[model samples]
Target: MRSEMPYANISGTAVAIPVTGGSLAALVRLPTQLPAPTVICCHGLLSSKDSSKFAAIVEDLCQAGFATVRFDFSGCGESRSASEASLLGTRLRDLLRVMAFVQEQDWNNGQLGLMGCSLGGYLALLGAADSSSVGVKALVCWATPFDLAGIRTALESGNLPHAMATASRQLGEPQDLAGLPPLSRVLVVHGQQDATVGWRAAIEIYRRMADPKELLLFEEADHRFVDPACRNMAIQASTDWFRKHLAGSP
Candidate 1:
């Protein structure tokens, strides 16, 4: 049996975006008594708040005295699947909104961190890697994809969703939020044997990142991290990243 990880619905947005014509929801898990730092969890492509993997991470973080908020990307989960036609930009905007929401919550005044898996991981670093990531104190990614255009090219010959290209092409150079110091801290964890997204992508991302970043390569791990050791490693590294940065540790 899985140990219970207490989580409560913190708030819901009536209109996530007017263009999407739907609402977005966020569920929060707070550390006991004294408020704790936060990890904004973003799920991967085609996944949602319903993903068991995300739930497991959320539970782990919460149990470790860290607060986390996980929400469904518009058109991905309970929010609005029909809006997928406009998905690419919609998800990025949704991430921006989620960040805004996390900063506003009562329990998140402390350092804010991010944990995103796969595609989610890509966007997390992309968001925080650039100067725009306000309130983003740290980042954790797993087998994250970079170079959105490359992914699009791979799918061009297939019947893959057209929305992928439409959105990837337009997400643009991430916004360089004015007035904020450059984002210098980052942590990336990827499977060296990942065949789906491949290890090359992760290395490429690592190169694009600035200093103060660490990448954990799981030698025998695959894309899903299905192996018990790999899964445990992913969890440990992610939790460790948050604890060190969010708690201001050396």
Candidate 2:
């Protein structure tokens, strides 16, 4: 069941999703129409559900007559933090839990989409690849890495948050994108000047995906996409992709 408590000072309803250890903090924004297609937004390693990027996308999606949900992964944002031993595996579980929760909501029309950034994007791929992610029709990945090696390097070098560095140690083997089955319609967006993850990762992801895939690269953008023009382009592109693929939910 969804929480009834009123969330203060937010445009959407605040939800507290029960998990094993605690709960995940999430915000749900609904369109004027009922039973609309739903999209879940996932933030990067250190970012939260309050990301400006997510806010922009959610606004556009709501206006397009789609519902959107943005949640904080365990140990990030408003969600309860985990122990030092907690790793990507824990975060994956959190995502799966959110997916399950969304499916149970009456506001969802059974058509689910995912939009993720950086590490969150990688997690979205893993969730969609999982056998349990039913009703997921499409996904969009932004500045996502193809493998865990670069993440491991970033974690070790203190480039990323220190909390994730300890978690990286437990991420035994590197994941293989080739092993992922063609789960759904995929859109890969990357910045040509992305020094953090590099544009090559986008190419690799695009190549490994099946048909119904697209790759968009911006020459002046970086991993964070700090520039307003670049960010708007990515947001518009993503919204267009979701609108096209998640047209009719049965």
* TM-scores for every candidate against the unseen true structure: 0.78, 0.90
Q: Which lDDT tens digits does candidate 2 get at residues 1-250? A: 7444432223888888888778889999988787789899988888999988889888888888888889998878888745334467777888888999988888778899999999889889888888776767889999998887765665667666644624445653335466767655899999999988888999888888877889999999999888899999999999899999985534
Clashing pairs in 2: none
TM-score of 1: 0.78
TM-score between candidate 2 and the true structure: 0.90
Model 2 alpha-carbon drift over 4 Å, by segment: 2-10, 81-86, 154-162, 165-169, 172-176
**How far is 183's C-alpha from truth in model 2 (Å)?**
3.1
Best by lDDT: 2
Candidate 1, 161-199: lDDT as tens digits? 533424333344432222223345677788888887778
Clashes of 1: 0
Lowest lDDT 10-residue stretch of candidate 1: 10-19
